[model samples]
Target: MPDRLAPLTEALLAAAQKAGAEAADAMAADGRAVSVDVRGGALEQAERAEGTEIGLRVLIGRRQACVSASDTSARTIAEMAERAVAMAREAPEDPTVGLADPAEVARIWNLSALDLADPAAEPGAAALEDDARRAEAAALAVRGISQCQAASASYSRQRIFLAASNGFAGGYTRTSRSTSAVAIAGEGLGMERDWAAESRTYQSDLPSPEEIGALAGRRAAERLGARKPKTGAWPVVYDERIASGLIGHLLAAINGASVVRGSSWLRDAMGAQVLPKGLSIFENPHRPRISSSRPFDAEGLATAPRDIVRDGVLKSWTLDLGTARKLGLRSTASATRGPSSPPSPSISNIALTQGDRSREQLLETMGTGLLVTAMIGSSVNPTTGDYSRGASGFWVENGQIAHPVNECTLAGNLRDMLMRITPANDARAHLSHVVPSLLVEGLTLAGE
Candidate 1:
């Protein structure tokens, strides 16, 4: 709970100051999780984990060092602070390594309106086991499903407190509940597998286990008897379930860290068109009850809505305090970090502009191509924007799904591919990344 975590962070900051650090930040996280997994109508594994972790980042002049430990005792906290200060003394100096300015820290936030933590009682182990068992049973009930490989239910709650020498101090609590199932449709060498999962901040908002399992079963059944498609340059439709990854690549490309290192393909693309005209990408960190919503970033900076891409033009790079300073730009308040790690720029929630057409309409527009429901591996060149990935899904012919496909590689230049994509309006509104199914033209497919 924040009540307990706050004192630990206060103790850490006090210890850091006593250890001769010029400035410092402390984070204390307390969390517990319970998970149950079922297979073959029986309980296969059950786990419960609970722990508290504390981290310290100390700055001596322009140098900094980070240390973390599971131990939260006074002696351990003091030792961590001393160790961090000593490490900072020997580390290379970086001008951007100090804490946020006191005036820049978030001072006013509304936690209740965000609705981050669910007030419901934690689910018991028996309840989780029952959910997993029911999901497995539902998957096995489907006619074509040869097996329910795994079904699981889980719940977790975490509270975090952050304090810094710059007078920034705040904490928040979060909870998550989830159910999932993986199904296999055929036997031995002919098997094809798929999965379905749903997670929500509130237990009541989570979908039923039977629904999750049945969806997994149907997805796997649809992949039976898959074969390679004819190799050629063809259109490709990235299904809504996985289309966010396509946009994720662009997000990575525009990350301030990558731009600073000159290693990103989009390093030279600021203010230039990245997507097709009329398309845009927006980021908002305050969406109520969403998993990624946060009132303040890791550096204690307020987070707000901003456009990363506007009308197809690259508008802003995702930035944290350090990256923003390095680029001589304002911070975007996108910092994210965990115990034992330093803060880095990370997007919260993003939505690519949706189109007016449906996914089926996009498929019809494509006429014939690969409808990628799943992808594996990656060979994306961050510097060159060349992209390739192993894919499997249905093969479409004459604007309709013809048969299942497998063991194929899709290749394209991300810069070119993004510019050519046509989005469909079926993006799940609940997700952090609300990207729609995307239709891209003339990609090289390596298959039969």
Candidate 2:
């Protein structure tokens, strides 16, 4: 591969400076990906894509504008810079928008320690097709599995570079591989579907196709005879597969962008108890071999581990430079951005404290409740924390699974839900959000 991105970003920065911008930043990304899908034990689709893109953000006084293009020619770069500068000149001034101070930029990073990219050669298209076909065949082999809806295998690699006029430049490469299978059980109106997937930064770390297919088949078979549970307020146990979404709600509420806009339910939750005592949410951006792990943020700021929630108390807000300044706080180095957008607050690798008990133990302790394994549409009131969603899962009675249930509405206020959650020790360690199965007490379920 050509070392073309570094010079491209540098060129964008130089163009922006020549266009008479007060400050500027530039980003470049080169990526390639291949994907294969199989169904009915045959290749359904195969795709390969490769592209390079560059973006320029120029600041005129306190106003800024971002523009991106796939073309890297010098003429195009100059035009992009000129357009961005013109747009910035006409845009309303936002005093908080500008490049990070030179001292605040990440001065050093260790990409090797992070192990973000795999060193192995890319898998051939035929190999990907074989993986997908195997997964589909395995699912079809399972008893009670009516069909393999879809099976897929994919691999991607991307290199990103960032350069700013304030003397900051950094770049990194990342790779990912994933396999998934979706299976259907029963026939006609009784058919139910479920899926299983595994993704890793390296191909060697991905779960086997057989394992993924078997899990998908089993999950679908388990839902073969799903019915609605009796309507009432019940304790709800979110299965490990879906439990991360509950924590995701909390994360969104504490996002600096939401907080600044007064749109988050957790706007006033700093230093307050948002989770059960002894539970904490930790962010570690430098975790090795994790897809979300990063040595530095999009704005070239150094990232480090921090406790977003400590012992149930709301501790910090996810922040980028702009949102931090808007709130009169220091940047948390949580900035994330794409080629066509400016940096914004976002989280990387995070893990919630796990409870001592296993998921089975938690189920036994609950005695009678709904064990939600999947959810559909959502209606969440961001400002008030009101939450309601369509859910489907197994119902627990007398400490055992009685039957699968579906078409139920789970309703509760998120502000109150997190306070009463009991985590089960079932989190997948390699996930970006390592939240375990969670049991929240007293949620209303609208069912039969």
Candidate 3:
């Protein structure tokens, strides 16, 4: 791996400027990954891979163009830079676009939270193959779990850096560990398929192999005794996974870019109740536990805790410096950047505050409501807040979970559901969103 990108970045920046570009930035990244599959207690597939790419962003006054390639030779890099500048010169120019403002770049390089150079993160072929064997063995040990469709483990890392004509320079390395299993349970009428996985930025944060297997096994077992519920309007229960997914959808609505673009349902909803009162959603970029936490945003802006939604009302929109300046709103430090795309708004370590009712009590109170485990799909018009999705889960009847149901549709306008949410206890150890179980009424559940 190349330790110093200064020489390469300067070369590219100079080349772009020579091509009539007013500003330029270059970024490069390299990483490795491993994946595996398991079936019938046997290893199915195994692979290891690594590669790197360099990208160039050039601005001809206001118009900007980006181009990237895997080749790293100086000749190729220079050509890439020149081409990017030429394209920018020909493209439409707009003042709202360019690299992040120079003022926001990170001056101090911080690697305190990351293990950028740990070779152990990238296991050898033999060890990676062994990991798959171990995961499958653990899954098969669980009683009633006859087999698994797949079991896999992976560790990967990325070393990235960016240099721009504005005199800002920065970069960081990140690592990830992921393990997953898909299991089969029962036979025929009672047969069910379920999957579960755990991902962590640090390998040490991942659960033990046995624990991973247990989760996959438990998910499959809990899905047994399936049946279809008589669909009608009743209270709806959203488990942690589904609840987190719903929250994922909400993040985009609060994105500052979307609001400015006039494409978000939240365009005029600020200060208005969006969820049930007492419901709070916090986006804290500096939170230590989350994999998504960042001290500085992708655009190099200092990140701060933001109340995206508070007491059931829209609070602040996610804002990057560019959008913030355009809209006359303060930057919320929500800028997110991928390797190739420019910075955009993203909520970091978002959490919906916990509620008081316990999961058990919330389930018991359902008493003839649909306990939605998985939302089969999300088909929502963010502009209209119209949401309808296929759902599957157990039926709660008279204080107990009865049987699994399928082919049910959960239909409700998000604007309406927001105010109707009845949150429950058990927020800790939920999904990434950390939302508690929730109860909602006044939705149409269509069935016979």
Candidate 4:
């Protein structure tokens, strides 16, 4: 595969130089994917795709432009480079736009330790269809499930290579396998739907189709009689499955782009306490078998584990080469990019510190409050940290779940919410964001 992609990237760089580009970088991706979807116990769709794409970024003085194409023919590569160079020449200059220094480029990496790709032979189309069928059948077999809306199984593999005139050249391959099922219960205006999905880097690590389907069915059934709770200030307990969103907000606020633009709520929060005193958030990009694991970033910078938050204090921002330069700081190697775009800051695997208590224990501590299981829509104010969103869940009374609740709004400021969070010890380690159930105190809930 390198034999094919290497030539395309080399041709792109050579073409850029020929077109009078002061510096250039090229990227190539050779990928294929197969997906199967089943409905009513029958195969509803099956898709297979394979292709190669090349992208070129040419720098003329302080200006840069990016261009990409699915066609890797010699003529197309030359045309793409020429077009990018011409665009760069016309673009306005930005002193922060340039390639990494040769000394800072990653010269070596260990792909084997990352274990990003599965070694097993690709599963056939028939096998994927069978998996989808099994999931649909299992969901339909559930006692209260009225129908299986959809069941899907998919597999994908991608090989990516990057090369630049700044002494950076590297490549890596990644694979993913996934299965999901959506189940429905009740009828007419009372109907509810829920889904469950699991994905893994290795096929062998995926959960059984039946298990996934049953979980989806059970969840849908649980919401059959959901009603709105009373409107008032209450403690809110976010379920483990949906708790990651709260952490994701923090991640976004601290992103280099948001901070640089002065649009993040956390723009002035550096070195201040974000989470509770004992809690922290850290990233591990090299974890074996994790989907986000990478040996090097898109710009060929060596990746490593780092703390986004330490002992509740804001530690660092997620930065790519451009954003780091804009902030007058060194790159954090958090750069990520697609074939058609330049590098930008993005995070990898993140783990939020868990608490000693279990989810059940947290519920008992809450005594009376809302235990949110699902969320929909949002009204977040990035500049002010205010947050409000549609929510559905179960109501707790005297340390016990009384009944399911739905169609309510939860409102609070993210700054206050993070400072009051009490985490539950129930995070799934394999997920890219390993945040557990969280309990926040004194939030306003709008319900009947």
Best by lDDT: 1
TM-score of 3: 0.92
Q: Give the per-residue lDDT of model 3 (tens digit) for 402-431.
A: 877877898888878877888887775513
**Per-candidate TM-score against the hidden true structure:** 0.99, 0.99, 0.92, 0.99
Residues 377-397 of candidate 1: C-alpha lDDT, one tens digit per residue? 999999999999999999999
Q: Give candidate 4 misplaced runs (Cα > 4 Å).
A: none
Whose lDDT is higher: candidate 3's or candidate 4's? 4
Q: Rank order by lDDT, top first?
A: 1, 2, 4, 3
Model 1 alpha-carbon drift over 4 Å, by segment:
none
Task: State the lDDT of candidate 4 residue by residue for 1-448, as single tens digits.
Answer: 4588887888999999998899999999999999999998778999999999899999999999999999988889889988999999999998889999999999878889999999999999999999998988888888889999999999999999999999899898999999999999988889989999999999999999999999999999888899999999999999999999999999999999999999999999999999888899999999999999898898889999999999999999999999999999888899998888989999999999999999999999999999999999999999999999999989999989999999999999999999999999999999999999999999999999
Cα lDDT of all candidates, in order? 0.94, 0.94, 0.75, 0.93
Give the local distance difference test score of model 1.
Answer: 0.94
Clashing pairs in 1: none
TM-score (C-alpha, index-matched) for candidate 1: 0.99
Report the lDDT of model 1 for residue 159: 90
Q: How many backbone clashes does candidate 1 have?
A: 0
